[model samples]
Target: MDALTSVTGDGQHIEPRTEFAPLAVMALTGGEPAGGQMVSFFVDDPEGTGTDFHGGSPVRVTTASDGTGTTDVPLLAGEAPGTVEVKVIADGAHTSFSLTVNGHPEGNSGA
Candidate 1:
């Protein structure tokens, strides 16, 4: 069976409308790298107050030699406090990254 998992940029706390770390996923089939595979990214913001893929959702990318796929673009927090969900799909396998857009950063008074 193939596998897809978020290797980074998951369960992070981000401030509203701010830039955070990059997201990446690994695609493996039978415990081996699934290179040259096409990985698709999607955004699930039910509150409509979260981020999206830079050019929009459903961004497609080909995995590298090490079975790694990354979002080459930037993903910022939305206009309000909410959770942003990024769903990664790879050859019928799936994984996800969740980020919370909390209000205000440390030492910021929202002034």
Candidate 2:
């Protein structure tokens, strides 16, 4: 299994205040069909200081026949920007990746 840095659905690297961010997960099964297979995603915040998931953690998705899947997870506004670890599990396979969320400028209050 592999996690994409920037999924095609969003076409942007995840950052602070990024809402409904699309995350793509790919699983390799020697060409085996993956349609209808369950794929689960979760975020691990070691310091307990990171972005928030709008629909909560451990979002689930169904993979396509090509063993690919996509899901949207929101990064709440004002979240402490830092390295966020994302994990994906599918068909008994697990993979993880880290993404850096750019911090918002201080004292730049929106009008």
Candidate 3:
């Protein structure tokens, strides 16, 4: 399979400078799982924003023999809330998705 089938996150809003549950990426072949593959994760920050991948981006991860992988994307503290584009590539197939970051409310400590 050369196409990304699906991309999803564990939460809708991500807290800045925090490591949340990984975003899941799925690959498929003929509607079936394309397992045992190597995939790479990338983040596209056009404006040189404060988003940080924690040395995670541009990294390759092997699928769990089920055509599924996870990406750990983190933002720096004081980073503005906005949408970010994430690119995934595998075996000449590539796809992109947008992730939204939610701002922490004032006077509320992010615990």
On lDDT, the leading prediction is 1
Best by TM-score: 1
lDDT of 3 by residue, 1-111 (tens): 756754676234577665544667888877778888788877776644456567646757777777898764453322666666667789888876666666658866857
Model 3 worst lDDT window (10 residues): 71-80
Q: Candidate 2's error at 17, in angstroms?
A: 2.7
C-alpha local distance difference test of each model: 0.85, 0.62, 0.67
Model 1 lDDT tens row, 24-88:
99999899988999998888988777687677788888899999998887787787778878899
Residue 93 in model 2: lDDT: 77
Ranking by lDDT: 1, 3, 2
Model 2, range 72-110, lDDT digits (tens) per residue? 555452266666666777767776656666666786688
Residue pairs in clash, model 3: none
Predict model 3's lDDT versus the native.
Answer: 0.67
TM-score of each: 0.87, 0.69, 0.73
**RMSD of candidate 3 to the true fold?**
4.9
Candidate 3 TM-score, true structure as reference: 0.73
Better of 1 and 3 by lDDT: 1
